[model samples]
Target: MKKVFLIICCAAALFSCRKLDQPNTREFTEEAYWRDAQDALDALTSCYENMSSDFYYFGNEALSDNAYVAGTGFSSVSLVAGGSYDPSNARVTAEWSYRYGAIRKCNIVLENIDKVPSMDETLKRRIIAEARFIRAYSYFELTDWFGDVPFFTTQISVDESKTISRTAQNTVLDFVLQELSEIRGDLPTNVQYAEKDRGRITRGAAIALSAKVQLKRGVWEEVKNECELLINSTENGTYSLLGTYANLFKVANEFNSEVILDLQYGGGRTFSTQRSFLPQTVALLRSVLVPTQDLVDDYIMLNGKAIREAGSGYNENDPYTNRDPRFEATILHHGSTITDFEGQVQTILTQPGSVPATNSVDDQGASPTGYYFQKHYDPTAPNYNSGLNLPIIRYADVLLMYAEAMNELNNLDADIWNKTVRATRVRAKFTDAGATEFPTGASQPQLREIVRRERRAELAFEGVRAFDIRRWKIADVVLNKPVRGIKVSSGAFNKDPNGYIIVEARRFEDPKHYLWPVPTFERDQNQNLGQNPDWQ
Candidate 1:
């Protein structure tokens, strides 16, 4: 069965006006829809469907250094990278409206769930908890992207919504934390869900989300506390890392032990993660989102050192050899083998004048960086209709967050390393014990950098890098320089004289660019919604 409800409540019934206060007048009005238990369930399901759209799942990566957009069109990625977008960009406008639209659905459900007569009290509480979880999620996304935004928990009239001013980001975050905390006990644990309800929010998920909210705010102690709650609840089977790193992303292994929260896509509904990342050699559609050389270099060598470090066994002439195991699992470089649509294995040839001619580096719509993403590719999917669920939160992420927060709150210790960072590396299949073990006597500053690099390598292309950079306050430093791609020319693959070719120059103006400007249209509609500092 599809995890999401196929029949979504009509938008007119949930959000006819921009303001959520007005009663839904569409086919399923508040009175007509809330009359029965099934009606409440359907409305609740619609909120989930609206909250986990594809844009947030995949498109947000382009806002960071993980991937580059193909064209110079007015796309959100291009505009944001160039520091040229304003409130009116189509993608920005869509994101604002989409999040609010989902919030409206949640509000409708929360406002009317109590009216369903004969509904089991336990069932009603679960539905209310789920709605609040989604509402908190929507608000988190809104505040993270746009900074201060119009905040309203209860449905407000159109006039009131128009006149409402932006709430401070800290205030919104406080509400998000409180909401998640209150709903934790009301939701089921990961082990309590039936097979059919695998993707619903759970107690562990609420805790994980709370940790993430604190992580974004740089509250290291709070983040550590929240992560420990879930990590220490192992007896309840709340969460654990899957046996292998690669298996965590397979379509057949979705909702596995490691997945805390994921957007459900199967049965008939699906996503295009593979289509967007697979090379044209294997996929019917051309690849658009290509990885950059900067990300590729971040992966450490198998010998427990960075490729650039001395005695790391890194061959500059043959660069892909002796690299991190994750490099092969996450990236499709030259000479990587892929099973084609015909169930035949084909080697990808990214170099010029190679036999079995594959797409050359820098080919139009091909991988501009000579690297395609293999992380979420599902070979069994028919054409571009892949059923692989996008993981919103995973056990590995919790471990990483715990490791980072612990390092910040207290210096890195052997026990913490074994539980979090070392455990993550073991799951990644690192055979050399040195590569997976924590270095003794490592200073806090050195360990901090190590943890940050681990996060970039482990979670690349998962739409987390953007937030990671922003939360770390390093976007201005890392994003201002030019993004580089691999050297592409005739004959043997030779490095460019300057090392790497500049693909795109990115700019992140401090203060204003850290937060997106409030949509010009939204500001125009609501005069009280002021723009971010230095933006107008």
Candidate 2:
């Protein structure tokens, strides 16, 4: 978010060496490059390089009540979620710059792709559509977090970059939706791609991302229409909830049928986050972000009843048992066992006074919340090698988005619920009919809460919770409460009367917290880049 005058061209090494084992490297410039298809491909490939690190992806969960990151003084998430950060917060700045950096890469490709000599017309159109998809996605993220922001589709001069003012979010939204609509036809369908061409942008990705953007905007009809196109309109390509809930996040199942769009990582690319999430007892890894009990409690019983419900069969002493099947795949609590890369199953004890306590609950540099996240832990990524692909958009999310839209429109009947919620639950391997069946005669309000809760449970810790709460306008209700941890009999942490540990007291100011403050560093460089309200 600085004056980041576009140099426009840098070493091809600045791009990813290999796009998931494909050798792609070439330099591009508006003046010198753009000789052939390879040049356009190389420039476009750079746009895909900014998928971000695993820490940033998972650390975003800390922005909600679902997770907690210990105060690191410089950790932007802890500072912002803790409600003490200002305009200079690094995440604010980094999030802005990184996306704009991506948009810039895409702009280069779109503006110059036509210049390539003798490239296949269809391939060139696909490449253009791919570039536009990335640009649209970046802008969606920017406006999602920043509200209104500087908008551009072409590379700008340093001075132009400095003086351009923030555009209205409505205008940016229109542009994003328009871009996706225009590009969807030009992109290939997911099934149309060859085996080696997997992970590239496709018509399905565009529609999925468009539905998400529409959902955020509360355009229920548009969301339903777009999701229906992907779900029922076979022309877009086939997508379904595939494999078990646990294997969904495993390294071995990176690009399964459930995935619509994913960030590719492999071939010397490092996809490492387990070291910061696992306790030190797990091969000396340490927890920087830990799961809050709030997240754990969101998992309903296997009988489809909440823990506090009349017949959930939930035991406070044995809380992890008889819960949602997804709970075991997602959370690692005290007494949970993890198999090492060497095939050793080690039980991690997070109790207050566990032995060999270096990585136990409440140990220094350990999980402050006494819980760990087990999802997306890549045992195959030994030495942090490329071992996982992060799903940006998946089929489950599409179903949930469609359900939310239908519910909001008062059209969430048994048929829609069966297609979306039931399909998603069945894919997650829910056994009990009560857990998977529709609640007949439910009012719109009840249906709303059910859909929201279903979204939270199904998509937790996948970098979607923060956006969901924000779009639902419930951040004030959720983020303002203290993040609670597990049931602690006695510990350094403050506990409620029921003995659940209070991890941290959180704060969220409505309207102000809804949109983060524009980074002060950006304002410093470009005076036209003014601060958001309540931040000045």
Candidate 3:
């Protein structure tokens, strides 16, 4: 949808106007603006544009165990991960404002779409559905990040905005679920979208996101039901695991069948994930998104057993070998080859005093974890601004969510295993009989760990890990300890047990850190918007 992006760019001024102040005859007014279909389309497109920011794509991973921020500057992520951030952190402020700002845009479209009398009835309904979907997605992010945020369905005056109080998260979720249910019939299925509109929201997208909302609320039965709707229904969209896991992220495979919802980035709009994740050797750019050993260790052996389990064939001395193939696809450890910007193969040497050490450059450019990300790398892109779409939700995530919800709601059966987890393993190229199939009679508890491990492996670095850990209530257990990295000491890779160096320590205080503090600025403006407990 290059045309959509272009329209978004040209209408940037209109999108940024947040105040719905009264319009005068001489000034450009809301009444004057929504005169036709183009106005509705532009307003809706601007909402989509707001969703394409880089923080949602890559920066959120640093908040979790999947990746570590190495730079020494004041990062809101480091502060939040350390449990020291208050409402004053700039990242928290920006995230809160950005999401609400987008919601305001969506609200504008919803309130004015009916004013366009000449617009096609079908197109108007679709536009309204799209606006509702975007608004629901925004509320989901806000409530998920900072619980009990101020909830509003329509644009309000400055006085009303200043007096708005936080709505309970469950109440907000109830409203979101209602919106999704009402609009599902209005949204087109993925297959129904014309070629130029392939990235627009579909019925499957709404259902998948609704299931995610249910999963977050710990409504296991509802999550199972919502996922089964997508899994069983073909009239809306057909989804399956792509043959190769690595190909799922390639630029050439944009909008592939496996993608349920993705932040579209093309038609002169793009992101800097390649620059953020690639090692200096490949892109000659700083590495801000370094994968952690904590995540690396989560990948089970190719034989489908934990590395520490008996007969798993794991070697601590040569730890990188005999690992799940996804480890190679997702991470770039030392001795890995990558195509440079000029198409030459280069080896990444993270060991100390090698031709280029892991800490070769300034602290800003180095990978403190001794590993760089390879999942979103686009070698053919001329530079950092690549047009690769990042998947917000995909079929594999749906399958894993289905499996987890089913195991929680009922017994873990072989049919569920084959349909969900086994299907994912087969896509990852785990063709061995033992690896592709779970042992029969695996208990519910056993299957829970298996599903959690699989989720970590398959969805690493996709910005979902932070939410996964938090919803599982394991953040305190996982985030309280030190984050580990491979050892690069005195010109060689250390193979001893101590080789795993402590990169940094993390913290997650109970109840308080479970949700981010309401921004200090927002609180200052609206006295009713009190800070989250423990932050005060």
Candidate 4:
């Protein structure tokens, strides 16, 4: 079913990538060009156009739950191995190509900015800052995923490209941090240039992204300080935590108060078909992406404790109740009656025989996992369409970053970590009134575990966990172990589908699955390149 949706989305809403073959296209003479504000805006908007790529969102499916680990016929199935990654894979190609495509746009923007003579100096600086932020962002993604990726600044000629060696991760990170820091003062907090200009980079977005980069590299002081600046500042009305967890992903909540940066979509021009994954249509998308039972069990109960914790009783039946409300709201489970943004209850049938009551319902068409994603989907919004903007960074992310940074720095006060976690439950009316006292006496290991668990529970299915596990040095314990998935209690794989609760077994992914190998084409093209340690 998910494959169908991918086909439909790819056909109708394909991403627009920047062309890299030509250094300059449709150029103007020195005497006539650089004399107008619109030209600058047009060029800037052109750079922003890269966000439309499915590459940034759905296309990076292997990074998240979109695909499952099966036999060798599929791409990226080896990510489940959890160890070393061969950089020669096609996934590396996709990452490298798309990033270089973005870098090319940055080169164009940086070189052309000086020519926009008529634009306001401040406005031009902001535009330049925006371009720098994007360039830095692309490089950051590249380095984090494939460490020691080839870093290019100015446009490269065909002959010169072959000689470029991969930059060391530290060197690339230093450059990105430097670039982001230098542009901090020049950018505006938010750009208010009417409708078309709404989604462009603002100061808040830049700092938020910089904070994220810092967090990934384990830069404790910088991460904490940057997050502090953003959370405390109200200069541009650019940051705030939304009242409800649901509101953060609602189709109606585009560019809401909590959003720092989002890949904005609209009615006709640039749009995404992500809404097609809702439980209402999960029957058709039988197995696109299913949440793991591990994730389902991770959400803490309303009492701010894990269900399996001592004294919690860990009731399997009626599990939806008493658990964190965000779990049910985010993942459409059995008996969940989700009303679309327009106030219409969706038909998300869960039982084997319960489906086929509506338009394409039947055992043959039901979700293979009997679950659906309810967030950011609008059933009433035409053909499973919702003008939902996909968030790239949000206030909650910054809060979590701060918590993790402080915890890692070993100077964390209990108040700081607890405040961040409580903020997530604020909309649910959760209070610490009767809960266990904050773990002020806990050791560093204990506190780190708490932060890690908090991130898993809060940011589940946000496409960050698999990579997060890699960075935290716990993938050996977490990923190598096979998790219990729902199955028939009678030991039949195909019979009585709903009778399954679960039992566990050992699941081992290779240790070499951590770093992806540099692509074969890239290595072939540049003799100076070498594959990651174990891959060659």
Candidate 5:
């Protein structure tokens, strides 16, 4: 199912992004519009277009320990990685602006869908549900990053927007959860949707997204209940693990049972995640989004033991051997073979002193961390700008969420483990007895660590790693160190004790770094939108 949904071609439905201080122009001609079903659809497309940004999708991995942006080209990703971003940082402003922009579009749809006369009652309700889901998701992103944010549901006038103060984060959470729950049943399941509508938000997406929001808040019971609805329900659309984990990301294999929600991209209009992550040997290679050594080391051995564990067959000289299958699927290290931009199998040499600097670790468009990501590779696409849809919420994520909630609630046991973590590992091709079977008698803390690591390994580069680290409260620990790279001599860069290149030094200030400060750009327009702590 090639879901070609978002194209910013509808001018009447669209409003160019602006600082919130500007006049509210979305409603300038909305009464003339929203006059029919086609009009409603046009306006809704605008919501999806604003919601989807390829930058936030891959750039988020760069924000966490999972990946590194090579330079300042991606100021938000790089600066946030360095933990030096202030209220005026580009990301601080962009994230705020982009989210509210999407929300405003969705609000237009929700506020005017009732005027589309002669539309099918079912279709009308479904459209309303979809718009609300998008709005809830936008607010979720806002509260997740900025903590408390100004909340509104209606078309507020320009002057009214200036007087709005930040709502408590808890109040936003309540509305988000209630909205998802109420609208979930109004939307169709993935199986019920027609082929062309494959990428639209489904009932399963509403439920799964709600679970994720609850998980972030550490509401273990609610998270457990919501995730179980999908994981165990027969009436819900079929959502199971794809047997081959790597194929799940290929463009040909998208919209499979594993994907609950994906950012739909096809047709001529597409984004190039591969270009941003691939080496310069491939055409259009940006290579700014390089995998970090810390992420690679977290992949458990095939025997299901951490490499540092006793009797695990990890050797510093040959680090890539016998690691988790996910390691090979997600990371393209030195000497790895990949289908290049020209549709040829090419061996990549990303280490220092490689003959061609463009393909080596030295160039701007090459892997600065000496590792390119294999997960999003789509070499056959035109100019390497792949039309492959990116998974946002997948069934594997729901399983992991189930396991986490179970563990956090002290309810994890053999049965729950088998259904969640073990089931996910099985689908990832983990056949080893140690990996596929539960670690019997493991304490809650031990299970917590296991669940968290499995979640990271399963979902790396899919844009949720930063949220995971933050919610786990371990960002301060994992991010406050040298982001190590491939093993190299001490001349080109500083090396860790293990000869791994220390690519960049980073620090995370606890209490302050937990929530992003509201951007100064927004505050300058509306001082009622107060700032988070410790930001200049």
Candidate 6:
């Protein structure tokens, strides 16, 4: 899978038209390519490979998720941290270059699909559908991130890529919806595909992404209806929640009823380690992503009340109890037990006398964020052998998306009854075993809040929170504050072994920070492509 990173680099290179002078057409149109089933399969896989590429997977995930925080000497942390970013520079360049490369791959498969005449009809259609879905998906991502991007359908000859200007965000989004709507039926439903097809795009994935796109465009009715169709399919045994919250993140529990779509990774030598970038890598003796105070405070109590709410049992100073149980499960801190996959607990002693304190982080790294992330940390795997499959789209997110759309559209139908509100209340009670109460009113905003909170608790640290905040127009309230660090005055702090809590004060970025600038190189190369406002 690490080799996929190189392909992504090639794609990035293609975006700048620098690699055009080389023999570029060979990979897209080799002599024997598009002749057989295996060729079609390989081409399809290549199309999907762009997703797992470092440029798309690591770079995109870090920017979208709060895991990467940019700071001085935090050169590697730019992915999540905002400081390392020049809103008008690096991010914009990467967006155009990577998406253009992805589009190229999609075009390669798409244009050649007809050439694979000997392949099975179903196989051929499926591969073509997957390519179209991915092409649309890539455009959706680009439109969301860059606001507007060139909608390239054909394999851009090096010259065209150099001259293409950004398309309007609306046009790109419309094109995404149109393509997804056209190819939705051709894609496979939620049925378990063959081993080779495990992570490929499915009809359900397309529908889910379409609903998300609709939601982003504020097309509440369409979003609500699309999600309802998927969520309500459970009556026919289509999709249902996994039995337990912990089971959702377990490697053995992957692709359960809860997952709509996921970026699957085999732990073979070829595949790169994704878990290494997550919290377990950091908390379990290596450094990776950390949880911020914003996340810590976002967890509402089990009673469906925010910690700041007057009636909730929240103590701002001793802020652990009476809060949501998920807070403990997802965030590792002073007293949380670090359990291995085999269920053996690793002692993380953060109190005085347990471990000697130091002034600076030495060997055992301190948690960059005061709280540690526990979203997908598998205890069974050895610390160095951490290899948990990351879930990109889960059933819980679909449920929340359904609720948000229904609330936005102000729909009170059976779909809403069966899918979002009732389904979520059941899951909420499942999390808090003693809680018997349910949400009473079904007002749009009320349901929206319920879904938002559910997303916060259920999807925390899968790197979705930051995007959710942006889509919901709540980033200013949630992320625009100076983040606090760990305050372990006398105990061993893992990321900071010396028990020294480093409080690096920061200023919240502005509205323009919401959108990244066109990379300097892209701006320099393409005169028609202008920088995002305030990027210069």
Best by TM-score: 2
> lDDT of candidate 5 vs native?
0.82
List lDDT for all candidates, in order.
0.78, 0.81, 0.79, 0.61, 0.82, 0.60
For all predictions, the C-alpha RMSD in Å is 5.0, 2.1, 5.3, 6.3, 5.2, 6.1
Worst 10 residues of 2 by lDDT: 5-14
Question: Over the stretch 276-394, how does candidate 2's per-residue lDDT look in tens digits?
Answer: 77776664655777889988888889877888879889998889998888888888888888886667897878888888666566588778777888788777766645458888788
> Model 5, 1-536: lDDT tens per residue?
10001111122335322221111235437557767776676677667776757788988888899999877755567888898788878877778877877777787788788887889898899878988998899899999999999888876766666667999999999999999999977899989987766788888999999999999999999999988889889576778888899999898898899899887677634786667787777755577788999999999988899989897788878889988888899988888888876678888887777776676767666777888888887876886667788899999999999999999889999999999888888877888999989899899999999999999999999999999999999999999998888888644677888788888899899989999998776677677878788876
Q: How many clashes in each structure?
A: 0, 0, 0, 18, 0, 19
lDDT of 3 by residue, 1-536 (tens): 11111221122244421211111112237546877776677677778876646665687888888887765332467777767677888768777877877777787788777888778988899989998999999899999999998888876766677777889999999999999989988999988988767788999999999999999999999999898888888876888778889999898888788899988776556666677678876767677668888898889988899988898998887889978899999998878888877889888877555665544422447786778899988877766667777899999999999999999986568888898999899888887777887678777888899999999999998889999999999988888988787764453333446667676778888877898888777777778888888886
Comparing 4 and 6 by lDDT, which wins?
Answer: 4
Stretches of candidate 6 exceeding 4 Å from the true structure: 1-29, 53-84, 87-92, 234-237, 267-286, 316-318, 340-344, 351-364, 380-387, 412-418, 428-447, 486-502, 506-510
Candidate 4 global lDDT: 0.61
What is the overall TM-score of model 6 with all chains considered together? 0.82
Residue 294 miss distance in model 6 (angstroms): 1.6
The local distance difference test score of model 1 is: 0.78
Residues 146-181 of candidate 1 have per-residue lDDT tens digits of 889888876777667667898999999999999999
Per-residue lDDT for 176 in model 5? 97
Candidate number that wins on TM-score, 2 or 3: 2
Per-candidate TM-score against the hidden true structure: 0.92, 0.95, 0.92, 0.83, 0.94, 0.82
Q: Which residue pairs in candidate 3 collide?
A: none
Clashes of 5: 0
Query: Higher-TM-score candidate among 4 and 6?
Result: 4
Residue 297 C-alpha lDDT in model 4: 75
